[model samples]
Target: MICIHLGSATAKNLIEIAGAQTTVCLRIALAGLLAMLIWRPSLRIDPRAVPGIVALGAAIAGMNLCFYAAIEHIPLGMAVTIEFLGPLCVALLTSWRPSNLILAATAGVGVLLLTDSAGTASWTGIGFALLSGLGWAGYIVFGKAVARHTATNDALALALGLGTLVTVPVLLTRAEDLPLDPWFLIGAVAVAVLTSLVPHAIELNALRRMEVSTFGVMMSMGPAVAALAGLLLLGETLRPVQWLGIAAVVGASAGATLLADRHTPAAPETPGEHQPIRPTPSEAVPVP
Candidate 1:
């Protein structure tokens, strides 16, 4: 989470100069190339894995684009809070117990407080953030499916590689805005490492361990983390109410973590949510 926000903050300066399309294109493109180099996915893969990888790729590509565009229009924390609604819904709908709704509502009310949708321009940011949420939901769903099939991050590497395709048009269109200097290259690489490479690698691994709802509940920390990133890195400020909202979000995540029962049966698979996916035997070798 810290890395992701750090990347967002880092990307902000680049976005200011290059525009959101160009900055995000560079970030994703570099990340994809690096991941492909690391994993070197086989030319042949499981046919069953294709849909999940494709969907995950599209989701990741779309989500980053929307989020980058939104941060250009609004504060990073606010954009993240709005974008969180996507996974929050996945948690609620996939939860078997009625009690989880309270957790979601607690987080929801907190986000409502953080959100200050007043002007047309702010609404435009909110609109993009909302779209990012949908893409995020797609990520949680398809990511789980893909994770179940792969022992390592091969699937993720491929998905990211495929996602680069989505950036081609954006890069071409924004070619005029892109900086050709070495400093820009350094910044773009940093953004890719912090945001796309680190976060996705960790998240895909986490999905391999826990249920989607559990992961979603835990991800309630995103807004608070992003807010801190905005304050410390971007010099953004939050109102007292927004601070309260952050507290609520943080508290909810902690509460959910403390209260979760490992033995609890996860809700059965829905479209975006899934039954607990155990790692394949290749992935399940006992830790030495």
Candidate 2:
């Protein structure tokens, strides 16, 4: 995740040189290419897995585009916090426990405060951030299904390949302005490796083992990560409340991740009473 946002900060730096659409098309395309080189998949996808793969690919494309558009207008951390709504929704909807609710609310309060800190940002940035959040939610929901069939690296590789395909139109539209300068190209390669390749592959591996809610809580840390990235890399300073928000989100993530795993209670059963078997944490969120 740190790699992901660091790549994003790198892209943000290049936006002025390459424009948002062009930078994003390049990032996705290059990342997909690297993933393909590593995985070298046969593209022999199961019919059942097609929908999930397609959805994940589309979600990646939309999320990347919208998030780039958002950061073009607002700071990276602010945009990421707004985008957290997507996974937070996934966490609550997939499984509901009182502990989950409290932790999610803590994260929610953090988002509110962070949002408040960005008092003067335009609605356009916020709207794009919201759209990005929706795309992220779709990514998480469909990603699990894809992982089940394709495994980790292949799943992310194939999805990024599809996302790269989606960028063809944009790339063509911006072809005239695209840069070939060696320095910029170097940064782009780093961006591809950090944001597009490493973080997503990590996410796929993590999602395969953990419950969606656990994953979501873990992902709730993204805002903090992005915030720090923005501060350190881009010099985008945060207000005191924004720092407070990060602390809240971190606390919620720590508590929920531990609590969700540790608290599987055994229901008492009488000799004749049949106890319904519960789904393991990873199985709680079904693809259907």
- Which parts of model 1 are misplaced by more than 4 Å? 116-121, 261-288
What C-alpha lDDT does candidate 2 achieve relative to the native structure?
A: 0.81
Q: For candidate 2, give the lDDT of residue 157.
A: 79
The per-candidate count of clashes, in order, stands at 0, 0
lDDT of 1 by residue, 1-288 (tens): 777888899899898888898888888888898888766666676677789999999999999999999998999999999999999999998988655678877888888877754243388888999999999999999998887665336777788898787787778887888888899899898888778766787798777667788778778889999999999989988888888999888888887776676445554343312433233221245311
> Candidate 2: worst 10 consecutive residues by lDDT?
272-281
lDDT of each residue in 34-60, candidate 2, tens digit only: 778766655776667788988998999
Per-residue lDDT, model 2, residue 162, is 89
> For each candidate, C-alpha RMSD in Å?
5.7, 8.4
- In model 2, which runs have C-alpha deviations exceeding 4 angstroms? 260-288
